[model samples]
Target: MRRPRSAVWLALRRNPVFYVAGLLVAVLIVMAAAPGLFTDADPSRCRLGLSREGPAEGAPFGYNLQGCDLYARTVYGARASVVVGVCATAAVVLLGGMIGMTAGYFGGWVDAVLSRVTDVFFGVPLLLGALVVLVAFPSGAAASPWETTAKVVLALAVLGWTTAARIMRAAVIQVKNTDYVNAALSLGSGHGRILTRHVLPNAVAPVLAWATIAVGTFIAVEATLSFVGIGLQPPVISWGTEISDAQAYVRQSPHMLVFPSAFLSVTVLAFVMLGDAVRTAMDPRERRA
Candidate 1:
C-alpha cells in the first residue's frame, strides 16, 4: 500500500499548472532580487540617435523612443513592480488578519463595529480609492523609488484589506467553534493566548492563500496607476512606467509596448496561478476536482 502524499508534494508532482506557475514566479523573484544578472546595460542610459531602433545584438528587444535599451529596462523593471506587490500584500495581510481575528473572536458590538468599517472600505473600489489617496499625497519628482513605492503600497493596503478581513473572520469563526478552542478556553487560558496559540494556527491558512493572490493583484493595480500617469514617476524603472512611455510611440515602435506589457502580464499570471495551486493543495475538495 502506498503512503499518503503530502498536499504540497502532491500538488507539485501531479499538477502541471503548479509547476509552470512556480517556475515563472521563481524566475521573476530572481529577476527582482538581482536584475544585473539579466543585463549589464543601464536602464536609464539613453541615446537619441538609437531611438526606436529595432532588435540588435546587444539589445534583444531593441530601444524605446527615448533610446534606452528596451531589454535592460524590461529586466530592471521587475524590481519595482515585485517590490510594490510584496510590500502591499504583507501590509494587507497583517492589518486584515488582526481586524478579522478580533472581530470574529469577540462576536458582539466589537464585531459589529469592525464589520461595518470593513464594509465601508469594501464599498470603495481598489483603483478608485487608490487614485484618490495617491492624488491627495502625490510623490515628488525627487522622491526615492522606495518612497514612491511605499506611497503606492499604502494606498493599496488602505482599500484592499476588506476581502482578507472577511475571509479570515469567516475562518476564525469556524475554527473558534472547534473543540480544541473551547478546551483551551476552559483550561483557564487567557484570551490572547487562546487566540494566538490555538485559533490562529488553523485559521491563518486561508489568509495565506489569499495573500499569495493579492500580491499579483497589487502588482496589476500598480501598473494601472502608473499607466494612468499617477503611480511611479520618472527615474523609477518599472514595467508600468515603461509601458506608459511606450503608448505614445506605439505606431512607430511597437516593441516599446510589447516587451514590458508581456512581462507584466506574465508576472501577474504567475502569482495568480501560484495562488490557485496553493488553494488547491490546502483544500482536499479541490484536489479531487
Candidate 2:
C-alpha cells in the first residue's frame, strides 16, 4: 500500500481534516500573535452598569458579569494561553529529547538508570504532580507574571519529558544501527557529532508530532490550573482565569462559561487535529493501516 511521495502529499491535501485543523490553528496563532488585528477594544475596560449585558451593537460575545467585553478578554487571553503552551512544549521537548536521545543511543547502565528514572516519574500523574510542585509558589504576595509562567512551565516539563524521553530513546535505538550511523561511527566521529549528524535528525519526527499534540494538552492543563487558582493570576488575562471567574456566574450569564470554554475547546481541538495530521502524514504505518 505504499504510495509515491507525491501521492502521499496529494492525499494529505485532499484530506479535509488537514485543512480544517490547520486553518483553525492558524487562526489561533494569529489571534495570539496580534489581538489588535482582530479586536481593538480593551479587554480590561469594565463598567458596573454594563455587567451581564447581552450582545450589543459590536460585542458579539456580550459582556461578562464584570461588565468587561467578553470578546476582547477572550481575544487577549489567547496570548497568555498560547504563550504558556508554546514555551512549556519547547522546554519539554528539549529536556525530553536530550534524555531520550542519550539513553537510546548509548545503551547499558546509562539506559537502565535513565529508563528506571523515567518510569518512576511517568507513574506520577501530570496534574497531581504539577499541582504539588506549584503549591510551593503560593498565590499570596502575588508572584510576578513571568515567575508564575516559569513555575508552570517547569512543573509541566518535569513530568512531561518522560514520554518524550521514551519516544526519543525508542527512536534513537531504531536509528542508531542504521548504515549512516555505522559509517559515521567507523569514521572516528565523536559521540556528539555522530548523534547530531545521524541519530537525532532521523528519530525526531515522531517526537515532534507528539509534542505538537501535547501543546493542546499543556494549554488545557494551564487552564485547569488557573481555574483552580494556581497557574496564572490577575493582570495576566488567560482563558483559564476568565473561565474560572465566569463559572460562579454561569447560571446568570451562561455566555461567561460558554465563550471561554468554546475558545479553549477550539484551541485544544485544533492542536490535537494538527498533531494527528502530522502523525498520519509522517508515519507510514498509519497510512498502511
Candidate 3:
C-alpha cells in the first residue's frame, strides 16, 4: 500500500535513529560542499617544517607526513569521497534499474538473457573486478583528478550494479501484476504511461533503500582501492589517500590513521543507519516490529 506523505513524515519523525543518521549525513554534505566553513587553512598547502607535528594552536588536527593540515585535508577529503559515492550510486541505480525494469516488464527471452548476464556479473566480486579493470586501464601519473575519479566510478558501477538489477527485477515482477497496474491497462492507458506514472513510483521504494546503503558501500570500496594504491591517486586528497599515506606512520603518528578512518567509518555507518530507517519506515511489517 502506498503511504500518505504526512504519514511517512510522521513515521520518519518517530524514529530517533532517523534523526541521528540524518544529522550525520547532513553534516557530511556540508563538509563536502564547503570545507572552508570548518577551517580556513589550506588543504593543499604543505609546510615541510610542520611534518608529522601533533595538534598545535592553528592546526587542531596537526600536520601529516606531507605537512598538509590534517584538519583541512580531512575536511576537504569529503568532497572527493562523497562525489565518488554519489556519482557511482546514481550510475548504478540508473543503469541497473533500466535493465531490470525492461527485463521484468518484457519477460520471456529478454528476462532470461538479462538475468543470465546479471548472474555472471554478480559472480565476480566487486573489489576483484574493479582491481582488474583499474589494472587493465591504468591511470597514468598525468591523469587529471576528474579522470581518475571517473574511472573509479565507472569500475564500481559496472561491477556493483547487479545487485540493484536483481532487486528491481524482483520488485517489478511483483508490482506489474498488481490491481492498479491491471486497472490502468484496462482503462486504455498506454504501456509507457502505465509504466512511468504507476509502475515506477510503486516499484522504486526498494531500490531507493538499496541505493542509500550502496552509497556507503561504494565509498568504503573506493577507500579500499585507494589504500591498495590503485584507486584515487594523490592530488585528489580523498580519505582513502590520507589513510594510505598514514599506513607506514601508524606508530609514529597514529592521528593520521585515526582521523580519516574515523570519519570514513562514521559516514558509512550513518548511511547504513539511514538505510535501515528508510527500510523500516517503508515496510509495514518492519514498522510494526
Q: Which candidate comes out best when scored by lDDT?
A: 3
| Full-model lDDT for every candidate | 0.91, 0.89, 0.92
Give lDDT tens digits, candidate 2, residues 67-133. 9999999999999899889998999899989999989999999999999999999999998889888
Pairs in steric clash, model 3: none
Off by over 4 Å in 1: 1-5
Mind giving the per-residue lDDT tens digits that candidate 1 earns over 1-289?
Answer: 3322476567557878888999999999999999999999999899999999999999999998789999999999899999999999999999999999999999999999999999999999999999999999998767998888899999999899999999999999999999999998889999999988989988998999889889999999999999988888778888888888889989888998999999999999999999988887777677667
Whichever of 1 and 3 has more lDDT, that candidate is 3
Candidate 3 structure quality by residue, lDDT tens digits, 1-289: 6455556676889999999999999999999998989999889999999899988899988899989999999999999999999999999999999889888887999999999999999999999999999999999879999999999999999999998898889889999999999999999999889879988888888999989999999999999999999999988989999999999999999998999999999999999999888877877676666
* lDDT measured at residue 92 in model 2 versus the true structure, 0 to 100: 88
TM-score order of candidates, top first: 3, 1, 2
Worst 10 residues of 3 by lDDT: 1-10
- Which regions of candidate 2 fall more than 4 Å away from where they truly are? 1-11, 139-142
Error of 2 at 243 (Å): 1.1
